[model samples]
Target: MPRTDAGVELAGVSVRYGSAKQPVTVLDSVDLRVGAGEFVVLVGPSGCGKTTLLRVIAGFARPDSGSALVGGAAPRPGRGAGVVFQQPRLFPWRTVGGNLGFALARHGVPRSQRPGRIAELLERVGLPGMAGRRTWELSGGQQQRVALARALAAEPGLLLMDEPFSALDALTRERLQEEVRSLAGRLGTTVVFVTHSVEEAVLLGSRVLVMAAGPGRVVEDLPVPLPRDPGTGVPELRASPEFARLRGHLTEALRPA
Candidate 1:
C-alpha cells in the first residue's frame, strides 16, 4: 500500500464520564495533529486517557466538547483507519486467512480478490504460509501477527495501535516492534501508537507525546532523533549513545513532578 495523505487532527477535544453531578474528565482540552505517514506514540500513566484519545481518533468515542478529525473530516469508524487492540481479538473459529478475509470483506474488497489480499497481508506480517491455521492454534506472538495482518487487510492509510505488543514476552515484543516499525515506514502508513513503556515509545515513535493524569493532557511532545533506516536494526539502534540519551530524557520527563 502506497502512502496516502491521511492525517489526524484534534482541537480542544474533551471527554468526560460519570454522573451529571460529578463528571470525571478523561481528556481535557487536548489538541494534537499527526501528519501523513508519521509515527506518533502516546505515553502516559494509567489514567492519562491515552486510549481515550485513540478512541476519539478511531471514531469509537465522541468528545464531549470540541472536535476530532481524520483525513480532514469527522472520523467515522472503520472508514479510513485500521486499529489493532492490546489483545489479538481474533475469532477462535476463524482461520488466519478467514480473519483477514473478514476484514477485506468489511472494507468492500471484491470477494474473489480476498484470497490474494489475505495472503499478501499475512506475508507482510511475517506469517507467510500459516493462514490456514486456526487462530487458537498459533502462539501468542503468531496470534498478534494475525491481528496486525487483519488490521492491514484494508490497506488503510491510518493505523491505530493501543499497546498491541504489551502481552508478548520480551523477545517477542522487541521483534514485533521492529517489524511494525519497518512495515509502517515501508507502507508509509500514518500511525498513532499507545504504550506505557518509554523504551517502546522511543523505539517505535517518530514523535512521542507524554501525557499526565487528573484531566489528561499532553505534557511533552518530543520528536525522535534516531534514523529510520530499515538497515539500522533495533539492536544496533538500542545500543547507540543517542538512543540511550533520548531514552533517559523521556524517562525523566515521565517522572512525577
Candidate 2:
C-alpha cells in the first residue's frame, strides 16, 4: 500500500479542444490522488485521454478547468517530475554519456562530476560502460535504457511515463516493466504510467486506474497486492491465480456498459 503524502493530486480536471461553441471534451471533471512511492497506472481504450491526462500532470497541458498538483503545489514545468515518452527521443548526435551529461548540466550538476553520475545511472539501468556508444549504435531497448538514465539524472520525486514501453517487442516490454516496477520501488519514486494493456497495468502498478471512453473519466481504481520482485519473480507473478483473476476482471471492466 502507498502512504498518503504530497504526491500527485488532480481536482475537477477537464480538457477540451476546438471552438468553445463546438468543443470536444477529452477529459471530464476528473479527480485523482496518488500517494508517495506509489506506482499508479492509467489504463484505457484508445482516445480515452490517458496521454492527455499524463500531459496535464507533466505541466505540458493546461486544463480547461480544475487544477493539477504535484507535491502539494502546482507543477513546475521541469522541476517536479521526470517524463518518459513512447519514443526514446534521445539526441541522435550525442553519445549515451553525452545525453545524460546534458540533463545533469540542466540540473546544474558540476561538469566534472557528470561522468561518475552518468556511469552510475547507466549501471542502474543495466547498461554499463556503454556511455561512449553513440545513441544510433544502441538497440531500441538500449536507447530507451539511456533515456531512462537521462530522465533519472534529475532524481525527481515523481516520474510520469507515457506508454514508454509500448514500442518495444513482447519480451523487451516485459523486461522493462519488471525493471521499472523494481526501480520505482527501490528508489521510492512515485510513478504515473499510462498504458493500454491490462496485463501491463496490473503488472507494474501498485494501483491500477481504468478510464472510460468518450470524455474520459476514471471508472475503476484497483489496488494490486502482489509482491515487488524486480525481474526475478515476474514469470511466476504473471502466472499466479490472483494475477489471472485481476486481469480477467479488468478485461471485463473495459467493456462498454
Candidate 3:
C-alpha cells in the first residue's frame, strides 16, 4: 500500500454563485483529505462541481466557506501547488525545451543548472529528448506529458489535476494514466484528481471519492485495493469480481436508495 502520510486537506468547503437575486450552490460543506504519495480521484456526473473543487485546492478559486489546506497549512496560491488541466495549455510559439526552461527560469534557476534540471524532468516524465521540437508538433498525449513535466519542474508539494486524461483516446489515456501514477509515486507528491470515469477512479486512485450532483458533497469515500504498478493491469482488475463489487458499491452510493 502507498503511504498516506502527506497530502492536501479540505474542510467544510463550499462554493456559491449569484447574489440575493439568484443563488446557485455548487459545493456544499465538502470535506476531503489526500495523503502523501497517494492519488485520490473525484468522480461524478457532469456539472457536479468536480472541477470547482480542484480549482479550490489549486488556489485558482476561493471557496465561499471553509478552507483548503496543503499539508495542513492554508493553501498559498501559485506557490507550492502545481496544476494540470484538461488542456495541455502549452505555449504554441515556444519549443518543448523552452516551455520547461521557462518554468525553471521562473523559479530563479541559474542558467548553468537549467539544462540539467530540464533534462532530468523530461526523463522523469518519459519524454526523453525532442526538447527542441515545437509543442504543436507532438500528439495530444505527448503534449500532456510535456505539460505534466512542466508542472513537476516546479517541485510542487502537491499536484492538482482536473480531468487531464479525459480528452485523450482510450489507449493514450490509459498509457498516460499508468505513467502519471508511476511518476506521482516516485516524486512522492500528493495528487487530487477529478474525473468522470469510475474505472479511472478505481485504476488510479488510492482513495476514490464520489460526489452528488446538485450540491456537490462527498457521498462516498472508498479506498481502492488495486496496486498502482502498471503491471497490475487495470483492465484485468476491472474484470475481477472484487472490482465489480466495489464498482457497484460506488454506483449505488452515487445514486442513493
Q: Give me the candidate number with maximum TM-score.
A: 1
lDDT of 3 by residue, 46-158 (tens): 88899989888877789889988876777766677778989999999999999999998887889899889888888988888878899989999999999998888778868
Of the two candidates 2 and 3, the one with more favorable TM-score, higher being better, is 2
RMSD of 2: 2.3
- Candidate 1 scores a C-alpha RMSD against the true structure in Å of 0.8
Instruction: Give all candidates' CA lDDT scores.
Output: 0.93, 0.89, 0.83
**Candidate 1 per-residue C-alpha lDDT over 122-197 given as tens digits, one digit per residue, 9 for 90 to 100:** 8899999887999888999999999998888878899999999999999999999999999999999999999999
Q: Is candidate 1 or candidate 2 better by lDDT?
A: 1
lDDT tens readout by residue for model 2, 1-257: 12234399999999999997999999999999998988999998899999999989988999999999998888877786888999999999998999999999998999999999999999999999998999999989888888888888988889889999888999888888888888888888899999989999889889999999999999989999887755447889888999999999899999878
Q: How many backbone clashes are present in model 3? A: 2
The per-residue C-alpha lDDT of model 3 at residue 44 equals 87
Stretches of model 2 off by over 4 angstroms after superposition:
1-6, 229-232
- Provide the clash count, candidate 1: 0
Worst 10 residues of 1 by lDDT: 1-10
What's each prediction's TM-score? 0.98, 0.96, 0.92
lDDT of prediction 3: 0.83
Of the two candidates 1 and 3, the one with more favorable TM-score, higher being better, is 1
